[model samples]
Target: MKPKVIRALGVVSALLFLGVLIAFAQPKGETVKVKGEVVDLWCFLEGGDRGADHKQCAISCAKAGNPIGLVTEKDEVYVMMGLKDHQPGKEVLLEKMAETVTVEGTLVKKGGVQVIYVSSVK
Candidate 1:
């Protein structure tokens, strides 16, 4: 094989390897159907705020652009996100703030933080 051809092949192989590594490195999420309470993350995590009494405040925080999250029956918490980029996950959960609701989405965990890209809420 010509030297130039061999060098081109080497570069292509390197690029292919890099692509594969990047793909693997990305956190591919899993689909989930979770029944939990949608809470304002800032108030919930900071002060353990939740329930009917906190509903109004939760809504206020959501309106103020605080992050929303879900806390499951088993005490698992997942930061909620939108299914697409440049969108806030709180859109769907705002009305359900401080209330228990079922949510369906893709859940991804990285660096000890769990995030769910919400697809549906009920």
Candidate 2:
């Protein structure tokens, strides 16, 4: 084989390999499903009251008795309480964390944590 031809093939192969790696590295913004026992509910409301200040809401929700937080077998954590349109104490079939009974929504990184904005529960 000609040296130039061999060099071209090598470059092509390298480009192809890089493309594949980039494709896999990108996060697919698809909803996934996950399932686990109801852990702790991290409610955004305070003292079971919906009309609380932001800081108060956080503290109150933590005190309220509900499973707003979810944990998977892999120790992935999610906060479900006080999100828009989501109800507390309701069983869910999450999507993004599909390794278990969880269902999907966009998994976002907030404050150095991975959380899914749950779209539905089955």
Candidate 3:
């Protein structure tokens, strides 16, 4: 093959490899439903804070723009995001803070952190 043709082929091969890597790196969102208690990240991580009794405080923190987290029955915790139009937006999580809830949304795990883009909470 001509040298120039070989170089072009190599470039194309490199681009294809990069595309594959990116696809694996960023996975598409998948619908998920989990039962857990939504908690204010601050108190939850610091003092083991939780329980329906702490509902008011958890809601307050969340309303104040604090990060919200969910603790599942298996003791797994995940960062929760209220997504609207593909961005962080409206939330049904704050009101359920510190209370057991069943939520449905897209679950994503990256960089060792679990995040759920919340859609509905009940």
Candidate 4:
């Protein structure tokens, strides 16, 4: 093959390899722990929401005559465990909002959203 063509092929191959590596390097499914204030919980049931935006769902629920059961924090590092099986309110077992506690569960991504399917809390 021509020298220029060979070099271009090599560059393309390298870029492709890099892309694959970056993709695989991301965490798939793992156990995680998170601590924060319970801000919203019910909207999570309808699906299509997760992460920082969870607070919005909480607020929305509160306005709509439903319990806004979501945990929110400014700097709390949520140890995200991949998705599992658990009810909305029963998943995270803290009684009040702003209560400091630890939650353990599988960090799962469903429909391009990351959430911890809580297993236990304290």
- Which residue pairs does candidate 1 place in steric collision? none
Q: What is the C-alpha lDDT of each candidate?
A: 0.87, 0.49, 0.79, 0.52
**Candidate 4 accuracy as TM-score:** 0.40
Best candidate, lDDT = 1
lDDT of 1 by residue, 5-116 (tens): 9999999999999999877754478999999999999999999999999999999999999999999989899999877654686777787888888988888989999998
Candidate 3 weakest lDDT stretch, 10 residues: 83-92
What overall lDDT, based on C-alpha atoms, would model 3 receive against the true structure? 0.79
Native-referenced Cα lDDT, model 1: 0.87
TM for candidate 2 is 0.39
Give the TM-score of each candidate: 0.75, 0.39, 0.70, 0.40
**How do the candidates rank by lDDT, highest first?**
1, 3, 4, 2
Instruction: Give the better candidate number (3 or 4) by TM-score.
Output: 3
lDDT of 1 at 95: 79
In terms of lDDT, the poorest run of 10 residues in model 1 is 83-92
User: In order, what is each prediction's RMSD in angstroms?
Assistant: 5.3, 11.9, 6.8, 12.2
Task: Write the number of the candidate with greater TM-score, choosing between 2 and 4.
Answer: 4
Backbone clashes counted, model 1 = 0
Q: How accurate is candidate 4 locally (lDDT)?
A: 0.52
- The true-versus-predicted C-alpha distance at residue 65 of model 4, in Å, is 8.7
